[model samples]
Target: MPRAQQIRSRSISASPFLKWAGGKNQLLKDILPRLPEKISVYYEPFIGGGALFFALASQRRFKKAVIGDRNPVLVDAYQTVRDDVEALIEQLGPHAAHATDAEYFYWMRALDPSSMSRVERTARLLFLNKTCFNGLFRVNRRGQFNVPFGRYKNPTVLNPDLLRACSEVLQGVDIVEGDFEALAERAGPNDTIYFDPPYVPLSATSSFTAYDRHPFGRSEHARLARAYRACLARGATALLSNSDCEETRKLYRGLWVETVAATRAINVVASKRGQVNEVLVVGRRQSAPALRQVGASGHAVTSSSSLRRSRAAG
Candidate 1:
């Protein structure tokens, strides 16, 4: 048996370990229903919290899973969780004990990740993610961890059971750190790819795409749109989630775009933490005999013809 598959453990359930911005835990209901019934390989390029990926893994929805992210720290954390959950938990225990201390939090945050080992770096990221302001993983122009202390009275920084479960789910899966465009290029026929790029700001002032040092501005979004289209052209089933705005709609025009209501909680402005509309753009290969779509209840609901009609009417 392959080394990746040899470590698989199906008895435990797994979920996202970090609190990520724009995590799709809330939108899984709408997103889950639209997935192709049969997926040979699954690709999630912008795997923020991997809410959708973990959910799909639990269902054994794909034969192979390839998940990647632009943030190296985030990617490292995933790898650490999969490869060395016990060591990560050991390192994180001290941080959890001092999570409420502002001085300790900033001290750990200010430490250079480049100077630490792989396990240390992952532990640092998990610690900051749990204790940072709003649990956001924002970086400065120089790629520095910049979010302030969250000041929560009690924060669960280490969950050994959750980490072990996540590790089991990650067995035999590809965890990469790189550009989404490059990752999307790997998808081909019978493959399903989900793109959850940094969303376009609703307004000029609401922009917060700085998940890393690189700014996901207009050009980046355009690049992503081109990638998404290219994936569809290559016979890969492509699905994308983005803000329901004129720019997003314009970019994904003529595709099967469905507006789904999502609740936003990460906004700095308290009033903006309410219901908002987001678009899910889906594209499947026309040559497929019968592309089946799974509904929220895990039942196949629609066929390729109806999906094509929806795209045509868009």
Candidate 2:
């Protein structure tokens, strides 16, 4: 059978295929309810793991969806999942078979992505992501995949069902690869834009801002803030999340801000891994109402005492 004909077409629930730093998997319950009740178009500019997008997709929440990211490799992986999933899956089998061998993991990581075919590149990325340390997509200054091998007891490098489900949900979606500022021009009235840009580092040492070769610095944060405000001015509902720090607060000043607890999963010091407060900023069109506050587990935070109580629980 032809490769295209071999691909199955069916509706199945999906989740983010890759484990990403700052992914919204844990915050979905709190974030989902805050989305606009009716969405004409959905936009997620920094669609990392796309936890929110996949969740909304499963619910059939919008007429159409547009997802973008600055990282080309990441965008390519998503495209492969959407269009060339069968080939990508076939390529992953060998990787999965040898996933436990550290030598093979290092060899795969060292290979240049440009030298590989699209499906091969996508498969390599998936393999590394699943087996790499903490499942992080960190690259070195030379644009190399440098994360060490993770000694997982049984890492799942190939998930045919989840990939097929992702492909199905992505049937009509438009995927873009570039800076998030473009959303200001692309998003308009009746649209809901979710900005999950690289968060401003709470402390200088805690920076996960090197998403790609380009570092998301303070200037990028300022530029994104402007783009976000522009989307709001153009009559779109915008939602964003970031570290609950003075810097992040300054960026979204005057916008509806909600504090929520999030577990810090990717940290060098194991002791520092725990529940931490993060801010959710909402910017809506003039007609939209203020966003309701939700705690870590998606329950409403009605009062200061309740907020304190929630923090204590975290």
Candidate 3:
């Protein structure tokens, strides 16, 4: 079997342990082929669910990696998995035993994650995330997790093997919490940065960008585009994902922008959940050798590739 197939066979361990909204797992087929074969350092600023990171790790793609997210709880979970997986698994034992208990679920949800230890906090988040409505990671103005309990049958509260696998993959990864612009400080030549920021809503009532109190509005998008350009200026290869809207296209004007179908899995209305076109923007390649590698791969996507606008098959 091929390496990718081998990795997929260990689904329990190789795959993302948590279910995430706007996860890239479903789009990997449309993504992996486009990724440059050789990468030195990998960076994912908005590391929600980290599906791409995990997949790359499974393939042993990069030399070193740094992943960050604005959401502190998500960062804590990643840190706990990297540094204290065993303890986190232990902390989740009791919660797993009482997984289906609604009273325990609410009690765990109300318990402030800030007040707990690292392992306890991660366990709390994982339990609440799995039990919450559709596993939505939304918070209010005060940064409090407010999603209500979910309706599901026999949810997997804890998976020790998968957590262990994730921990192993995150061994050398530097996990951080803060704005996406932080990547500008760490990114260097030959580094690969994938930006999976909160998508600009497709419609007026479809706002789902609120991962925390700070919504990713137009200004944020513009700032991210600047950051992307800055990374490219420093000789880093960057790929970004966003809603395939006119504004997003305009924001990333003069870059490689292509549309791919992404399944809408997190919509409140079931009728609205289906295939939707999402944009994939690839930045300019600076190094001659890197450009050669892209050509060898046959994709040959560059800053000017946006002009052709290759339609990505979902």
Clashes of each: 0, 0, 0
- Whole-model lDDT for model 2 versus the true structure? 0.81
Q: Candidates 1 and 3: which is better by lDDT? A: 1
Q: Which ten residues in a row have the lowest lDDT in candidate 1?
A: 305-314
Best by lDDT: 1
Q: Over 4 Å off in model 3, which ranges?
A: 1-12, 285-314
What is the lDDT of every predicted structure here? 0.84, 0.81, 0.79
Question: What TM-score, over all chains together, does every model reach?
Answer: 0.89, 0.89, 0.87
Q: In candidate 3, which residue pairs get closer than 3 Å at backbone N, Cα or C atoms, i.e. clash?
A: none
Q: Model 1 misses residue 188 by how many Å?
A: 1.0
Q: Kindly list the per-residue Cα lDDT of model 1 for residues 1-314, writing each as its tens digit.
A: 23543344334578899999899998776677677666899999999999999988887789999999988888998999888877887888888889789999999989999999999999999889999888888999999999999999998988777887898889899999999988899999999999999999889998888888888899989999999999988988888999988888788777767677889879787898899888888763243234345556655565443322234244
TM-score of 3: 0.87
> What lDDT does candidate 3 reach at residue 180?
89
List, residue by residue over 117-230, the lDDT tens digit for candidate 3: 988988988898888888888888998888888867888988877887788788889999998898656787878889998888778998798788888898999999999878
